[model samples]
Target: MYNLLLKEVRLGVNPFFFVLPLITGALMLVPGWLYFIVPLYFCMITIPNIFGGYKSQNDLMFTSMLPVNKKNVVQAKVLLIVLLEVLHVVTAMIYGKISLSLYPHLHYIFFKPTPGFWGLTLVMLALFNLFFISMYFKTAYKYGAATLVASTVAVLFAVEAEWLGIQNQFVSDLFKGSGSTDGLTHYSILFTGVLIFAAFTFIAYRIAYQRFKKVEV
Candidate 1:
C-alpha cells in the first residue's frame, strides 16, 4: 500500500499538480475573495487531468495486472485524492492566515478563511470523492461522467453553503461573525468536517471496490 501510494505520488500524478497548491493557495491573499474557489481548483483541474492521464497511460489495465487487489488500487487512488485535497486546503489556509493578518478589519461577504471554512471545503471535496469514486469504478477507465457529476455536486455544495452563510444570521454568526471568534465552535466544525470526510471517503472506497470488482478489467 505504501509503495502504491509512492507510485501515485512519484509517477501517476503530474509534476504540475505538486506545485498547483502553491499557485492556487496564493489566491487566498486576495482579501475577502470567494475562498472556496481556491480548493475548487482541485475539483476543476487536478481530478480530471490526473484521471485522464491514468486512462491514457492504460493505468487501470497495468495496475490490474499487478499483484495488488482492486481494493488496494482504489484505496491508493482515493488516498492520493485526499492527500492532494489536504495540500490544496492547507496551503490555502496558510495564505488565508496571512491575508487575515494583512487585513484585520476587512469585512467579508462570503465565508472567511477560517478553520471552519476549510472544514466546509473538506465536506465539499468529500462529496466529490463519493460521487467520483463510485461512478469512475463503474468502468474504471472512463471518468468524464464521474468528473462532471462529482464536480457539480461539489460546486452545488459550495454555492449552497455560501448562500446560507450569507442569508442566515445564525449561519453567518457561526462562520463570519461572533461565532468565527469562538475557537471551540470553529474548531468543532473543523473536527466534524474531518470526521465527515473520513466517513464519506470510506463509503466511497467500499462502493468503488465493489464496482471495480465487477469490472472485466
Candidate 2:
C-alpha cells in the first residue's frame, strides 16, 4: 500500500502539481478576497489533472500488472488525493495568517481564510471527491463529467455559504465580522467544522473505495 502511494508521488503526480497548490494558496495574499475559494481552487484544478496524468502515463494498466489488488490501488490513490488536499489547506492557512497580518482591518462578504473556513473548504472538497472519484472509477478513465459535476457542487456549497454569510448578521459576525477576534468561542465552530469535514471525507473515501473495487481494472 505504501509503495503504491509512493508511485503516485514519484511518478503519477507531476512535480508541477506539488507546486501548483501554492498558486491557490497565494490567493490568501489578496486581502479581503473570498479566501474560502483558495482550497476549492486546489480541488478544481488539482484532482482532474492528477487523474489526467494517470491516463497519460497508463497508470491503471501499469498498476494492474503489479501484485497489488484493486482495493489497495484505490486506497493509495484516494490517500494521495487526501494528502494533496491537506497540503493545499495547510499552505493556504499559512498565507491566510499573512493576509491577516497585512490587513488587520480587512473585511469581506465572504469568509476569510479562517480555521473554520478551511473546515467548510474540507466539506466542499469531500462532496467533490464523493462525486468525482466514485463516478470516475465507475468507468475508470472518464473524468470529464465527474469533474464537471463535482466541481459545480463544491462551488455551489461555497456560494451558498457566502450568500448566507452576507445576509445573516449573526453568522457573519462569527466568521467574517467582529466575532472573528472573540478567541476560543470564535474558533469553536471552526474546530467543529474541521471534525465534521474529516468525518465526511472518511465516508467519501469508503464510498469511492467500494465503487472502485468493483471496476475490472
Q: 72 in model 2: Cα distance from truth in Å? A: 0.6
Quote the positional error of residue 204 for candidate 1 in Å: 0.2
Worst 10 residues of 2 by lDDT: 185-194
TM-score, every prediction: 0.97, 0.93
- Residue lDDT tens for model 2, 1-217: 9998998899888898889877878988987888767877766688888887777888888999999988788788778888898899889889998998888887676887676676677778778777777777776777789889989998899899899889999879888877777778647766776677677767766777777777776
Best by TM-score: 1
- The global Cα lDDT (0 to 1) of model 2 is 0.80
lDDT of 1 by residue, 1-217 (tens): 9988998999899899989999999999998899999998999899999999999999988887888988889889989999998898889989999998998888889999888998898899899999999999999899999999999999999999999999999999888887788888888989999999999989999999998999998
What local distance difference test score does each model get?
Answer: 0.92, 0.80
lDDT of 1 at 205: 91
- Which one is best on lDDT? 1
